[model samples]
Target chain A: AQSVTQPDIHITVSEGASLELRCNYSYGATPYLFWYVQSPGQGLQLLLKYFSGDTLVQGIKGFEAEFKRSQSSFNLRKPSVHWSDAAEYFCAVGSAEGYSTLTFGKGTMLLVSP
Target chain B: EAGVTQFPSHSVIEKGQTVTLRCDPISGHDNLYWYRRVMGKEIKFLLHFVKESKQDESGMPNNRFLAERTGGTYSTLKVQPAELEDSGVYFCASSQGYGETQYFGPGTRLLVL
Candidate 1:
């Protein structure tokens, strides 16, 4: 079974400040990793995904994540966060071996302040 | 292109009542999936459908939950004699094919009182 852990339940960051959301996973093999963001009353939006590519993958909305195999982690990052970036972010792990079913973390709520 | 869509954005029902949720996948998508997120918990997978066939349903909680995808189009999940623990946000997702990136719907929030 694949499981993901997001240590931070809540995080606060000032506008224009760099942000990082930690994510760790336990999978038997190389897993498909993803970051999703959900704003109020909206569906989960895909941010970035790592599926056998460069360790650092870029995504929409100026988001990026690095996949470190040795650490079993895929952490999301942004150079600078905007107030609009405040939302709940989730880290998920999947695999073709598992029929592409995703196992998600508990999620990290980002609170961006001015 | 239209994204995956779910009906009855919010549902409030009695604990013993029944509720049915609907999901319309993106046109031409061959894979549809169901998931649930209990408040403060990680989202959990419920089932997977390939066309009109059930590919995997190991995550389904019990027999009270019945999901059907007729004609390989839209899908419906019916929960009968619902329990308080069944109250949660149910999400539907669709993908073009197996192992592809999935697009999610807004989700149907079911609250059982």
Candidate 2:
């Protein structure tokens, strides 16, 4: 079974500050990792994904994540956060061998302050 | 392109009542999925449908929940005799094919009182 763990329940960052959201996973093999953001009253939007290749993957909205195989982690990062970036973020893992059904982490709520 | 869509953005029902949620997947998408997020809990998978066929339903909670995808188009999830524990946001997603990236719909929030 694949499981995702996000250590932070909530995080606040000032505008223009660099931000990082931690995520860890447990899977049998190389898993398909993803970061999704859910704004208020909206659906989850894909931020980025890591299937293979480059460890650092870029995503929409100036977001990026690094896949660390040694640590079993895929952490999302941004060089600078804007106030509009405040939202709920989820880290998910899917089986590369199966139907790609995702196992999501308890989301971390981000609050961007000015 | 149109995204996955769900009906009845919010539903408030009595504990013993029944509620049915609907989902319209993106056109040409053959894979549809149902997921839910209970308060303070991680979003959990409920079921997966591959063109009207049940690919996986191991995540379904109980028999009280029934899901159907007629003609392999839109899907519906019916919950009978709802409980407070069932109060949460139910999301529908669709993908072009197996192992592809899924597009999610704005979830339907169900509150059982």
Candidate 3:
């Protein structure tokens, strides 16, 4: 079975500071990776997804992630974060078999301070 | 177009009581899924429905949890004799097709008191 691990349970960053969230996954084959963000009392919104081709994938809200095959990691990065960026971020991995469901990490809470 | 919508944003029920949660997927979406997130845990898949038929229900916790979709449009998840463990946020997602990106709903927060 595949699984995901997010080493950081909580991350605090000052407004306008750069941010990076770590994510690692364990899967047997090539995996489809995704990053999602959830605000308080709101549903999850897709931050980005990586299926194939480019190793670096750009997402909305000026967020990006790079897929590193060697490291088995797909970490999310932003040049600058706003207070509104504070939320819970989840990292997920899906198998190539098609029928497989997504395995997600426990999530990392990003706290952006003023 | 509206995103996936779930009924009763929050619900509080006594233990052993029966509760039903509804999910209305995005129109024209052929795939719908149910997932739950318990406190301090990752969001876990409960089941998947392709139209009106259940394609995979392996993630369902137990027989006490029942999910159904009629007319391949909306879905309902019912839990009978709910336990404290069942208290969590239930999220419903829909995809255009198999292996496609899924759009999630606001979720129904169930509190089993």
Please count the clashing residue pairs in each candidate, in the order shown: 0, 0, 0
lDDT of 1 by residue, A1-114 (tens): 789999999999999999999999999976989999999999999998988868999999999999999999999999999999999999999984545489999999999989
Model 2 interface root-mean-square deviation: 1.1
What's model 2's overall lDDT? 0.95
Best by DockQ: 2
Q: List pairs with backbone clashes in candidate 2.
A: none
Candidate 1 regions with alpha-carbon error over 4 angstroms: none
lDDT of 1 by residue, B1-113 (tens): 88999999999999999999999999999899999999989999999999999999999999999999999999999999999999999999999989889889999999999
At residue A2, give the lDDT of candidate 1.
83
Against the native complex, each candidate's DockQ, computed on alpha carbons, is: 0.78, 0.81, 0.72
Candidate 2 wrong stretches, greater than 4 Å: none
lDDT of 2 at A6: 100
